[model samples]
Target: MHINALKSLVMDAVDELKGQDVVTLDVSRLTSVTDLMLVVSGTSSRHVAALADNVVEKAKQQGIKPLGVEGRTGSEWVLVDLGDLVVHLMQVETRQTYDLERLWSDFPSDIHEVRHGEQA
Candidate 1:
């Protein structure tokens, strides 16, 4: 699927689920496998799992299947790979621990703090 279309679908799913600190980073220049990385924090483990599942279901509904899913065991952090778009659904603790956002800080990441606004 087109990057923008996939982005829209993922954003909608996360927003509908009330995912917090939703952010999208363009990692095309730094990563070889994927072009975009979307990160969001769920209120709890169950919420994290549901958020990931929602994204998967919505993508499948739109004829887009995930390449793979990870971290469903404890549901602390779930990573969904959709070829060009990789999504990270994490609990607040997990998100802070990994800090993927800070890891890719050199890039001009368009942090979607307001659902539709630029980085803060």
Candidate 2:
């Protein structure tokens, strides 16, 4: 799937499940690992897991298979890797603890805070 379309699909899925504090980082110029990174927060462990599942399901519906999924066992944070996009679904506390936004934003890049699937 195209990057933008995949981004929309992922964002929509997160919005559908009410993922909190959605943030999209354009890392294409910063890294070759993936073009974009989406960091989302969930209310709890279950919410985090569900968000990851939803992203995977939505991608599959569009014929996009994820490269990998991690952190489902604990559910505090779940990551869905979709080649061009990598999604981080984490519990609020975990998100604060790791502070991915600050970590990645340290470098020069476009950081967009997304709310309800729209840039905030």
Candidate 3:
């Protein structure tokens, strides 16, 4: 699938899981590590885990397998690596503390603000 399509799929999955603060960063120019960076927030540890699981399952259904997953056991900050894409699911507090947005401020990204009642 195309990179943007894959990105939309991932975002859809995150939306299905009711993830908050979902943002998609176009890191193609900033780094060679990945084409895109998806950042999402979960209400708590369990919520984060659940969101990650949902994303994994959704990706599988779409025929995209994650290369690996990290931080699942603790669920503080789960990172799903999909080679071309990297997804980060974390608790609000953890996300705030890590401040990934600030960390990767140089990268050009499209910020999609998810309103509470809007469709994901």
Candidate 4:
């Protein structure tokens, strides 16, 4: 699937799991690592893991498998590498500590304050 469509699917999956602070960063100009970075926050470790799992499953349904997934065991921060779209599912604390948004501040971002029960 196209990168933008993949991104939307991933975000929808996370939204289904009640993910918050959903942010998408366009990293096309910054580096060749990936085209987009999706960062989302979960309430707890289990929540984060669930969010990540949902995203992975949804992506797989669309015939897209992540290149790799990291930090699932701990669930403090889970990273799903989707070649051109890397997804980050993290607990609020870890997210704050890492401050990935700030680290990649140069990239244009679309921040969505996800509200529960709302359609993504």
Best by TM-score: 2
Question: Cα miss at 88, model 1 (Å)?
Answer: 0.3
Model 4 over residues 57-112: C-alpha lDDT tens digits? 99889888789999999999999999999998989999999998778874455433
The lDDT values for all models are 0.87, 0.89, 0.83, 0.84
In order of appearance, the predictions have TM-scores of 0.89, 0.90, 0.85, 0.86
Tens digits of lDDT, candidate 2, 2-53: 8889988998999999998888877788889998889999998989999999
| Candidates by lDDT, descending order | 2, 1, 4, 3
**Tens-digit per-residue lDDT, 1-120, candidate 1:** 789999989999999999888888777777699888888999999999999999999999999989999999999999999999999999999999988888787456543223345643
lDDT by residue (tens digit), candidate 3, 1-120:
788788778888888878998876666667789877888999989999998998899889988889999999999899999888899999999999998877787445543333334554
Clashing pairs in 3: none
Clashes of 1: 0
Candidate 4 C-alpha error for residue 110, in Å? 13
Whichever of 2 and 3 has more TM-score, that candidate is 2
Worst 10 residues of 4 by lDDT: 109-118
RMSD to truth, every model: 3.0, 1.9, 3.6, 3.8
- TM-score winner between 1 and 4, please give it: 1
Which is superior by lDDT, 2 or 4?
2
lDDT value for candidate 1? 0.87
Q: Judge candidate 2 at residue 12 and give its lDDT.
A: 93
Task: TM-score for candidate 3, please give it.
Answer: 0.85
